[model samples]
Every structure is written in structure tokens, then in C-alpha cells.
Target: MIKKDVLFNEFLIRNATPEDAVQMEYVQQQCYPTLDPTELLNRNHFINHIKVFPEGQIVLERDGVIVGSASTFRCNFPTQESTFLESSDNLWITNAHVPDGEWMYGIDMGILPEYRGLGLSKEMYTVRQEICKELGLKGQLIAGMTIGYGKMKEKMTIQEYCYALEIKKFTDPTVTPQKKAGFRWIKPLYNHINDPEAGFACVFMYYPVDDNYKLECKL
Candidate 1:
């Protein structure tokens, strides 16, 4: 276990390198049992994202050990179905489409259980937002998870087993912590289109990286 003072006093936040991918993969696997950790850690994808947005891909280290990881990048409106799901068509209409601008997207954020609840997650978000501001980003967008979707389940026309496994519940304590850091829930977005069994509901959240948004930490 990490020491109390060490958890509160100081932590290292830096851009993740290819060397950190293995440990990051471990952290993701430990944190999200239901999700496929390998998908995020695939060497090619990890390298591609890092090469594309090195500053946006970050990791938290404590005593030289990788304990948490997050990746942020510019995301445009959903012109196509989510890569996480199959099927070519899109579903559900919402006025909350992504507008033209350099909108920041928080793609993944995870921390190991032993190091959780120590305010490190929020600190990581702060760092991400700072990076966005430095890059002249306008807003940050996220597709948050949701639960209690009985009607949505029927609309997708999927079975119970697939539904239970695929449909993510809203209010994930892991991601919701971002609200305190400066995000506001925006609208609902779909993960899987037309597949009720695998379809998942997501709440979009936005946080403007404007002058009015104060930073609690020095960048």
C-alpha cells in the first residue's frame, strides 16, 4: 500500500512512453474487469496514439511505478459508428452533435485500486485540461457511461446475456470524479447502434477550457 503522506504530498504526471504500456495495460485490466483491457494496450494502437498526440497521452507515476493512465485528443462529431462496435449505420438523433472546433476528448482514464480515492484522478484531469488550454482547445467532450436502460434495451433488440455484459451503467465513480474537476454532463450518445444486446448508452459531458475555468494547480 502507498503511504498516506506520499499519496497526498506529491505525485508524478508525465507523458506516457512505449515502455509504460505494459504497466498501463495492467492498471486498466485491474480497474475494469468487464472491459477488454487488451484493446487499449495493443502495441500498434498505443504507439499510434502516442505518436499522434504525445502530450495528450499521459500517465501517473508514484515512486517510479506507473499507477494510472489517461489519453486526451481532438474528437469531431460522430460521422460514423463507434469503433468499439460493429454495424455501419448510425442511430439516435441528438442536437448535441460535435461542432467545428478543436474539441478535447478524454478517451481513457484508469487507476489501480490500491492507488484510488487519493485525488490523483482529478489531478490527472487537471493536467489534461491544462494541456488542452495550452493547445488552444475550446471544449472537452466525453462519452460517459449510464445504467437503467430497460427501454433502450428493447429498442436495440438484444438478449439478456448480451445486454447485461454490454450495456454500461451511468454514474461510474471512476469517471464521474471528473465532474468535480470541471466537467458538466451534456447529452446522451450511443456506443453500439441498433444492437440492443451490445448497445450501450453514454452521457456526453463538456468542460470549456476558457479563462473563466480556474486551474487549481500550476501547469
Candidate 2:
């Protein structure tokens, strides 16, 4: 458990390295306990991510412990539908990560359950936007989990659920926060992952660095 003073006094958000792989993996597991084992990234995956895009891997530390993390890579706007595995290069981020791509694709972000609601996610999103501006990229993109879907599946269809979210009929554990952080839903993706909680679906979202950028939505 983290001390109370540490939360208000100081917390460090810094670039992740190979050494942080184990801790990052632990946080990932904790954040998505229901995710399929194969869908979750491992320690080796984190190390590979750091090696491939060191600047895009970041971690939050409170009292020297990594309590949160965000992973990303450069990629162009998706012109076709893609699954989480395809978009993230099967979690290794080696094949699809482009050096000079137009968008900063967020692969994953996790803050320990006990450490959430502290504006940590918002801070991370801010950092990601700053990175976009610094690199002159268009903006950030993510296949956000619809974590509230499983419970609502018996009550409503996936499409209906998404519509409710759009109309603010209800809130989602994952998508709501991202929306509050300024992400806009581009579309809904089916079979995006193996999470039964999300009905194996996810929402494709984007946060443009500025208003002038437009999505070329070929779908």
C-alpha cells in the first residue's frame, strides 16, 4: 500500500526501461484480471516495447514503486478494421510500429486498482498529448475497452450499449474516463480482444492534437 503523503507530495512519471518490465507486467495483470492470458502482455513484451519505442513507454512511480504505466508506438490512422492484436503487433509492438507514423497509438495503460481516481490517467493522457506535439504527430489513438459491457450484455445489445454511452445514458468503467479525457469514439470494433467482459469488443477512439486534423475514415 502507498502512504497517504506520497500521493499529494510527489509522484514521478518517467520513461520506462527494461528494468521496469516485471513490475509493469504485474500492474497489467492487476488492472485486467479478466483478460485472456494470451491477450495480456508479459515482461518480455514490455522490454521489447521499451527497445522499440523507448520514448513512448512511460511509468508512474509513487515512493519508488511503479504503480501505473502507459505503452505506445507510432502508427498511421487505421484505414481498415484491425483487432487489438493486429494493431498492437500481437503485443510485441515490433512489426507494426512505424518510426515516422502520423499518430501515437496507445497500446495499453494501467494504474493499480488502489492507486486509481487520483488523476493519474488524466496526467498520462496529457503526457501523451505533449509527446504528440513534441514529435509533431497528429494525435493519440486507442482501442479502448468497454469494460462495462459484460454486465450489460444481458440487458442490452452491444450496439445499444454504445449508443447509450454516446447519449450519456450510462457510463463505462473504461470508455467513460477516456471520453472525459477528450477521446472521441471513431467506431466500435468487434473481436478486438478476448475479454468476455467487453463481449470481445472495444471502442476505437482518437484524441487529435488540435481541431484541424481530420480522420480519413475509409471504413
Candidate 3:
């Protein structure tokens, strides 16, 4: 038990441990079909993350089973620029973490099928945002997903679809919920993820850890 229960009915969310890799791997495989399972983190990776910044890694537990996980690391990346991140391959290289980077890069967030649609994802993002604020991080860098684009591609251009999403006319299953949690779609990127659901591209988004949320915190 990590002291903070994060009570949500029968669910509990807490910081992850290196020992959680097995459970996290299972949840990742079950929830994230678009990602290559082989690319998923192993024990060593989880251990490294736990050592690097355990505050940024969170897991949701229900009935003594891990149902969701979120991974993040301090990274050197342009928050306001459309830089093309090639793949997840080079990003997870060991010892490549920047402990004091200006930005906190969200690496992954997933929830088991049985645990979906219960506002758990929003809870995880809230945890991440809290961690960023604690570490004095500037902003969050997420390659947002346009999950509903694949089906809509047949009826509209990618440009039109993204515009619709941007203007609140429509919402995607994944990104829209995240947007509701305060992330903004800043730009689009190529090869950000292996998923085609995003039209082979993912939106680059930025979320600030605003001090305005705290009464005594200064901007």
C-alpha cells in the first residue's frame, strides 16, 4: 500500500513499483492493441522508470488486480514546435532520461477493457499533472490520438476531421476525453505512433501544470 488510497468506489490508484511490470505488461497487451507488444516495457524498463521518476508512473488496482498503468519521463522536447518523433524505439533507451528536463513527456497510458469508460483515464492524467507540478515541470508533451478518425476518413478529409475535432463539433474516443481533462491539441505529427487509427499520425498536445489551481502558488 502506497499510503494514498485514491479512493474511487472499489478502485484504488497509486504509484507504481518496479515489481509491477508483469501486471502492467498484461494490462498493456489487453488494452493497447495498436501498439506492438514487443515494444512494451519489460521488468528492467519498469525498474529503471521506478528508479528514475516513480512519481510519474501510476497504476490502478481493483480487487487486487492491476487494471491500468501510465508511464512518463522527463524529456528534452519542444513543447510548442511540431517536431517529428520517429518512434518509441529510441525514446526508451536506458539511461537516456533527462532528470531535469523542461518538459514531462507522457510515454504511455492504458486501461484494461473491463476497466474502460469509468473515468479511470482521467484520474491517471490528473495524477500525471500533479507529478509535473510537484517536480516544477513546465508542461506536458503528449502525442494525442484521433481515435475516431479511421472510420470518418471515408467521409471526410483528414484536415476536415481534425478541424471538426478542434472546433468541438466532434470528439474522438481517446483524445476528446483527454481534451476534456485540459490538454490542448497544439499540432499534428508524423509517425508518432504505430496506430493507423490516428490516420498514421497523432496530434501533438500540450498541457500546463498551472499554478492557478493552487491558492498560494505564484505563476
The prediction achieving the highest TM-score against the true structure is 2
List, residue by residue over 1-219, the lDDT tens digit for candidate 1: 111223555778888888887887777667655543333344444455566667677888888898988765565534443533221111111122222337667666788888788888878777777777777776676654443343456644323322343344343453357666777654445553222222455555677878485433211
Candidate 3's TM-score reads 0.83
User: How far off is residue 91 in model 2, in Å?
Assistant: 0.7
* lDDT of each residue in 57-164, candidate 3, tens digit only: 788898878898877777766523332233332435334457778667776788898867888888878777777777888767787766777687678776677799
lDDT of the candidates, in the order given: 0.57, 0.87, 0.70
* Candidates 2 and 3 compared by TM-score, better number: 2
**Segments of candidate 2 deviating more than 4 angstroms:** 1-9
Candidate 2 residue-pair clash tally? 0
* Alpha-carbon shift of residue 24 in model 1 (angstroms): 1.4
**Model 1 misplacement above 4 A:** 1-9, 36-40, 77-101, 147-172, 191-199, 211-219
Query: Which should have the higher TM-score, number 1 or number 3?
Result: 3
Candidate 3: minimum summed lDDT over ten consecutive residues — where? 79-88
Give the number of the best model, judged by lDDT.
2
lDDT of 2 by residue, 1-219 (tens): 111223466787788889999999999999999999988988999999999998889888887899989999999887799888888889999988999999999989999999888878888888788888888999999989999998887888778889999999999988999999989888888888899988888888899999776776735
Instruction: Write the number of the candidate with greater TM-score, choosing between 1 and 2.
Output: 2
Candidate ordering by TM-score (highest first): 2, 3, 1
